[model samples]
Target: MRLRTLLRSSSAVVLAPLLAGLVVLLLRADGTLHPVPGYGLSVLTAAHSALPYIAAACAGSAAWEGGRLKQGRVFEQAPARGRLGIALPVLAPVWLMGLGGYAVALVMAAVAADGTAPDLSRPPIPAVAALLLLAATLTGYLAGLVLPRLAAGPVALVGAFWVMAFPASWQTPWPRHLVGNPITGCCGVGQAVAPDTLWAAGIFTAAACAAALLTAHRATVGTAVTAVAVLALGTTLAAGFGQRMGYDGTVPRAAAELACDASARPRVCLWPETPGRTAVVAQIRTETGRLGAAGVPVPAALTQDPAGGPDTGVLGRTGELSPEEVTRTTAAALLPAPLGCEQPAREPLLGWLTAVATGEPPSDARVRAVLEQPRAAQSEWFRAGRDSLTDCGRSGVR
Candidate 1:
């Protein structure tokens, strides 16, 4: 009976955040996601942006568990002190243990689930864990209100973990917005989704909380009610947030236009416009090194005529020092008539090892290594540019 009660207790814990994650996925799935060049910008950017919400999702689970206590369906039972007795031996231990497991499970699922848009890689494990804890703290208070001293907590937690394992719908109303909230999920879409999604999600969350608060004050909380309310909250959060974060339209027309004019492959054109061609050339160099070899396939013009054409890798690695050797080599190839480094369309002038070794000094490398990067543009190239400066007498490699 104890085990059964505990199992039942965990329901809300897992359900809320998982639903929230699902909501984000659903919302963002329909939007535009340009492949930000081979610098891997789009993918990397998506990854970093996604972590905060994942943390929130983890928290949603914890919150769901706590809601039982706060709302007095279970955890708050016993003769005051008796509640502590129940908690130390059974509730608190289980709470911590289960939370760890559920958090790891959810994060692993997210990391493995998608690679295309939501970018599952950016969030560090620790940060996600912290967020999960925060969510749990809020949730625990609610769990206190409606659960039976012996039954509420375990049921909410176990159930919460379960919800995280599958795709679910989610929504929320105010007051208790903390439980079914979807605002965090909106972070996943980047700038792709509509701003209204925020208000929409917030309104729903406010309503849910209000109902939960009223139910608590009226002493109407129960196991069945716990299950229904939490499940509903989780599902709505997942579905609603999914809509907000999921991308919908075409890559901004500008993304396509840039790609076409790039004189490089479609990917080269895909990068956000802020980084200029020279910086792009630097990024190409870096990717080519990662991909290995110099003659990889690219756009046509770059191959046929040099001088920053889109064909065959870009001129220099984005983060590598401005290697005079590479720059000289590329400058010569693209304009052999003037600079004299061309070896024909089929062959590239530089090699992987050579490119890696190229960056020269004004100590550009030092600067790139230390500069702060913008949220979306935090790539090797951006870091490098922050470090780069032209200086006379010195080789231009820095």
Candidate 2:
């Protein structure tokens, strides 16, 4: 079939509305990407966000095409082309339509990042997404060959969505990782998509596509056996690899050169993509100075980099930098780091420290009582609270 004819007749003609919907979804979903505009993160997020919709559309369209082929007896007629050749041309438009949607998503991500260059160090999420979509298309086409024409499209549509979406809710974290969803918690500036996650998705989707193709082409018995063995091996490896990843399929990103303001007493460092650095640095300096005057020990440096020392305080990784945000981060920095174990007794002290750092009155009655004491007495109590923060056994407030 000619390219023009295939496009005109294929479901790609009606995909405009779907693509438009995808664009809207991309824009709305990209709000979190705005603060950290790393291209690799943006691209990965866009691909995962767009996957469910694009996969459903591709699968449904391919199913319809498959039904049409079956109804026309294309397979039975022994046409000039073989089964694989005939199906490929018919399904080409659907596959290309899906790819077009992914392209649009990438463009939107780039736009969201204000055209920042991609972090090339990160895994190839977009490529993995393309492979995953190809597997979905083939799976749907296979469904059409077996089911009644009226049932194939709807079945493929629902099944594709379920496969892409349902795993996210599973108690077992690995299943979601194996699917093309990537990771939702992915990619603060300090994080990257785990390489194992990409490998798992790639392996599974590639295996699925190969199996579907072999079946569609009517392989010999020996070929079928080989394909099944390969499929099983791929599944085992993908699942094992995915199980080892964190729930969100991310890892601490490798260190990169940061933008730092060295003029301040405690140097302030941030990701290069962070906006309004001058304002952020000023706020940090002002807040830290106030805390120091109040007898709180300030760190030697404030950095947003994940690899910074325990003594170094961290700034917020997302959102616009503001005075309130700076004050909160600075105050929290003065406190002991969370031990992950609960320490409810520390709430009053935490509240008091935050109030002092921000120059706000304490809201809690217990904290207010502490503030009413003389400056020397209050400092004693504050020092005790800071020192005992990690002592979970000390349930009584000082």
Best by lDDT: 2
Residue 217 lDDT in model 2? 83
Candidate 1's TM-score reads 0.30
- What CA RMSD would candidate 2 show? 3.7
Which stretches of candidate 1 lie above 4 Å from their native place?
Answer: 1-140, 162-165, 168-200, 217-398
Please, what are the lDDT tens digits per residue for candidate 2 over residues 240-319?
88988746787765556478788977888876656676887887787678767877778888877656685687664544
- The lDDT per prediction is 0.37, 0.75
Q: Which consecutive 10 residues in model 1 have the weakest lDDT in total?
A: 248-257
What TM-score, computed on C-alpha atoms, does each candidate reach?
0.30, 0.82
Candidate 2 regions with alpha-carbon error over 4 angstroms: 14-40, 75-81, 107-123, 188-190, 219-221, 272-275, 341-352, 355-380, 393-397
Tens digits of per-residue lDDT for model 1, 1-398: 27656656665444545545554474355432223322222343333233333433433444444454455534345545543343333334333543454344333334433433333353422233333343443344356444554564465455444433222233322211222222232222112223333333343434443444344333444744764576477546634644544433112122222332344333342223323555645554554343232222323332211234434333322222243543444433332232233222212222222233243222333434323334233233322321232222222222
Tell me, by TM-score, which candidate is best. Answer: 2
Q: Which 10 successive residues of model 2 have the least lDDT summed? A: 30-39
Clashing residue pairs in all predictions, respectively, total: 109, 0
